[model samples]
Target: MDSRTMIASLPCLALVIVTLGYLGLCVVSPFGRCRACHATGRTRSRLGRIRRDCRHCAGTGLRLRVGRHVINHLHDEYEAAKR
Candidate 1:
């Protein structure tokens, strides 16, 4: 392909590659460490003396990946529609 054509398609190719990689990640490992508590399931107080459950992950130390959540929602919708 000509350099011009190649350059034009670069963004699209990058997007597809990223999308596929995320899908693979979702399938291989659906849950990722929570961001709020750094996967420790708890947060420390300002004084570092008290700990509280991570509100974002509900103390599980893991949260559903976005891609996996979207996949799940789509599957649920498909099933409901199939009924």
Candidate 2:
């Protein structure tokens, strides 16, 4: 309504929008490229000679997004509580 009120609410509105966008992203694509090896599943030595499998993603080149991981943990907790 008033300018002051609208300005105060702007941060909340922006946060909600960003949260919803992240949730949608997590739902649509739960797995993201591994950060360690950049989805190549292998990393090279500092000299770029020897290559080794990525330990972070176990060489799968994919990792659970943080949001998706949190969602899954919450779901597991809810199921346990329900039981």
Candidate 3:
């Protein structure tokens, strides 16, 4: 294929891959980066000498992905009922 065709298709190819990855994450981990700390779970001072916990996930390095919270909520309710 020519360079022009390759360049034109690059975006579509990327979109497909991104969509597949997102779907896989939704089906699997159901976790997303902690926006508070940008997924680092902690941040360093400007001097890089000090770091702190992510307050959100409490430095767990992971957070529940969007739309999955309700699923967890429902599961919790079901478990409570079972017990």
List TM-score per model, in order: 0.85, 0.89, 0.49
Q: List model 3 lDDT by residue over 3-75, tens digit each.
A: 9999999999999999778766776888888888888889776798999887788898788876477667878
* Candidate 2 local lDDT, residue 61: 98
The best candidate in terms of lDDT: 1
Q: Runs in model 2 with CA error above 4 Å?
A: 45-48
For each candidate, what is the lDDT?
0.96, 0.94, 0.83
lDDT for each residue of candidate 1 in 1-83, tens digit (9 for 90 to 100): 99999999999999999999999999999999999999999998789999999989999999999999999999999999999
Which stretches in model 1 have alpha-carbon errors above 4 Å?
45-48
Question: What's the residue-level lDDT of 61 in candidate 1?
Answer: 100
TM-score of 1: 0.85
Q: By TM-score, who's the top model here?
A: 2
Q: Which is superior by TM-score, 1 or 3?
A: 1
